[model samples]
Target: MENTATRLADIHANIARACKQARRKPEDVTLIAVSKTHEAPAIQPLIDAGQRVFGENRVQEAQGKWPALREAHPDIALHLIGQLQSNKAEEAVALFDAIHSLDRPSLLTALARAMDKAGRQVPCFVQVNIGDEAQKGGCPISELPAFLAEARAAAIPLAGLMCIPPADTEAAPFFAYLAKLAADNGVAGGLSMGMSGDYETAVMLGATHVRVGSALFGVRG
Candidate 1:
């Protein structure tokens, strides 16, 4: 198997190529390695290779993996990128640096209560259902402005916005839309869009952070 250092260099090369194609500075886009379902053994070498930010899809999975990995590598940042249950809000708040799937008021309320109880403020991104897919778990685009207003009223730090484009859609326009929304909201950080498949397009469209899994780690078992 290729060592973590080799894999990281390869991934960085890919990011640089993508940035060149997108006409963006290589530093403008941040790569967030998605470490869901994989264990710490799989991640440690990557940490050693200097990857600090990771995205996890499930709260339970992250809760299990983070403690040990954190003990070993205290600076790693964990982001929650999956749909969050209100019941899991407290643990999620405690474990993740940022939650990227705050889609409803109930979830926000739960996170607020959890933060209050923990006495720690957590940054969060509002997931926008740009594709308007009924099966997806993001808030409707039309409801975003009001949602932001409400979140602001509640003193929740609205870090930025995240979205997943339709599977068949070209990712650039969707990513551009997200960048536009972030600009409109006056929040200049945290556009957590794009994945391994279309991250190059995402970089061109000004993605601040791109979640790359298979491209970095190979296919998950």
Candidate 2:
């Protein structure tokens, strides 16, 4: 538990240093401890150490775990950071505080209807395929303008942009491109880029939220 606390502090310090270098405030950055695949016992230590925000990769997995955890700690905010199925829209809206994998118009329409039905508009980050990887789950960059317009027309609360850059490539340019795209398109939460390995670079390039897993909980087994 103590070691987990120390790890959290180290990540916080690194984020602060990065924020300072970028002329940004530490408070501007939200650290989402990615808890996907980690059991409740493994997660309790970070919560015990004052961590309150967490991200999960699947709706069913989150549904199975978070209800009991939230019963004990209501302040935790859950984020959906993985690909979301259109059929799971309402469940996702009900279960998460933020949805970071909104990549298509079909999902957008479903989420809009779900949010209206549930009366809970969870902020959504428009996932951009910064690397243009066909295997990834973001909208193609060429479609961003039209896609974002469609989201606005459907009344989805835009939470800026999110991206997972090509693996092994320097991530800074991709991060910068995301920031620029958000600014150019008037997309609004802030950038949700960066992970455990390249979060400092993400922060430096204007990420408003950083999703970190291994850096916080150690490598997932």
Candidate 3:
């Protein structure tokens, strides 16, 4: 197996190549290595290799592994890439630098209150259920207007939009549509889209941030 540094280098190379194909600069895309379910010891090598941004699936799990890690690696940025419960809003605000699952009005309200209480405003991406999947957690397409308005009114800083295109499906059209939604909604921040399998196509279609897991860390065993 490739060492962490070698794998990190390879992913950077792929991002660079993808940026070239899109006629975009490599710096324009942010890579959040999804470290969910991976142990802390396994993560240090990548941190040692200078990979700062990481994504986590749950607040409690993140709290468990990250406190000590961030203490040792203060510059590391933690992003919440999973569904956020309203009850965890305060903890989430205290822990994550950014959140990618601001999908509902209740969560929006909770986050707003938490941000105010914490006296810290963290950037958040409003997750869009672009595929209208029944099992997914995102604001339905028709609800975007009201949902976005609620988010802004509550003073939550917006970081554009986020979506998970249907698995095993052609993702380009969904990416393109997401880009259009962001533009129409006047979002000036990043589009959090694509995972390990389709990040290159996402970058081409205007994804500003890619969440990569297995490609960088190998399959989640």
> Which ten-residue region of model 2 has the weakest summed lDDT?
212-221
Best by lDDT: 2
Clashes of each: 0, 3, 0
Query: Model 2, range 41-147, lDDT digits (tens) per residue?
Result: 99999999999999999999999999999999999999999999999998999999999999998899999999999999899999999999989999999999999
Q: How do all models score by TM-score?
A: 0.93, 0.98, 0.98
Each candidate: what lDDT?
0.86, 0.95, 0.94
lDDT of 3 by residue, 6-104 (tens): 988988898889889989999999999999999898899889999999999999999999999999989999999999999999999999999999998
**Model 2 reaches what TM-score against the true structure?**
0.98
Candidate 3, residue 190: CA error in Å?
Answer: 0.8
Between candidates 1 and 2, name the one with more favorable lDDT.
2
Candidate 3, position 39, lDDT = 89
Over 4 Å off, model 1: 20-23
lDDT at residue 56 of model 3 (Cα atoms): 98
